[model samples]
Target: MANVIEEAKSGRASCRTCKKTIAKGELRLGVEQMTQFSDTPSMQWHHLLCAAGKLPGELKGALAGYEGDVPNRADIDKAMTDSIKSGKAKPGAFPYIDKAPTGRAKCMQCDETIEKDSWRVAVERELEVNGFMRKSPGYMHPKCVAPNLENVGGTMEDLVSQVKTNSLIDEADMDAVVEEMTGEGGGDGGE
Candidate 1:
């Protein structure tokens, strides 16, 4: 449960929460946590804003101890505030974009490509074994959400609103992401 801000030694490491490269020599937030794969805790790297979006409740303590430069402190604060106010209790479970940080994921629904910078829905399936809980992540293209989540009480707009409050995506980007997601826009992805 230790955190630090450090320079990325190389481009090989990407943000665990964003899947985007933190340019070499750029300072990044590293949050340590226990994982099933290792006896020792591993450091999880995240862009400042990404950390704010994904783990707002923990950001304060992490930031309090960090001494390195945070180039976008204001933006990070705003994102963290928004996420904290989202009041969903468990932000991680909310379907979000980029969202799971899987570099190249195939949709579980349509088997189509989820390219970088495009909208992809993240859903988690929880398993309880004996006494502990574990989660497995699944991905879907925006168009695939309806079929994949056919019976979910909320609508596409609800998902978008959740993502907006919990992720670093801006309103303008969300509009386009929503458009591409709902098939309201051309299929070219506006590229």
Candidate 2:
């Protein structure tokens, strides 16, 4: 392997396939095409995978006589993952969270169109400093959490602010509730 520092000092090199001299400070990778212009040279331009003998046999078999390097598993995986993440591969076999694209769900407060999976709750704040003031603190979908507050509208904000000071009132007394409504947990004494 040629030292990158040494190659940089020597300056321009050409891609074997294009025969164009690559200028200084050009971003390049080992597998990217390159050539050595010499009257008599032992070294020759080789596809990085072919030179490294890293090409998978199955991929090579699929290519038949095509000599160029095929993408490795990591490259293929990254591309697939990127496709899934970018919404380009709908119904792809992405291993992460399952996604179902429903139409936009309007925010109760701001009314901004949010993806069904990207809704947020704007809880009102009740605590006032110096005077009575209200504010809405937005709670967001797991995925769209970062920008939840930005989309809140005036009406929703007021509602959210009003809610902050009020504790939730539940009519049902959970402590006095039976463990089971069915025969289990002594709900009914069996014969």
lDDT of each: 0.68, 0.31
Candidate 2 on 122-161: residue-level lDDT in tens? 3333446579665533333323322343343344234322
> The CA-based lDDT of model 1 is what?
0.68
Could you estimate the TM-score for every candidate? 0.45, 0.17
Model 1 over residues 62-174: C-alpha lDDT tens digits?
56557776888899988887886675423333456544344588987788767765667676656576877876667787777777665333776677665554444556666
Clash number for model 1? 0
Best by TM-score: 1
In model 1, the runs with Cα more than 4 Å from the true position are: 89-191
Q: Between which residue pairs do clashes occur in model 1?
A: none
TM-score of 2: 0.17
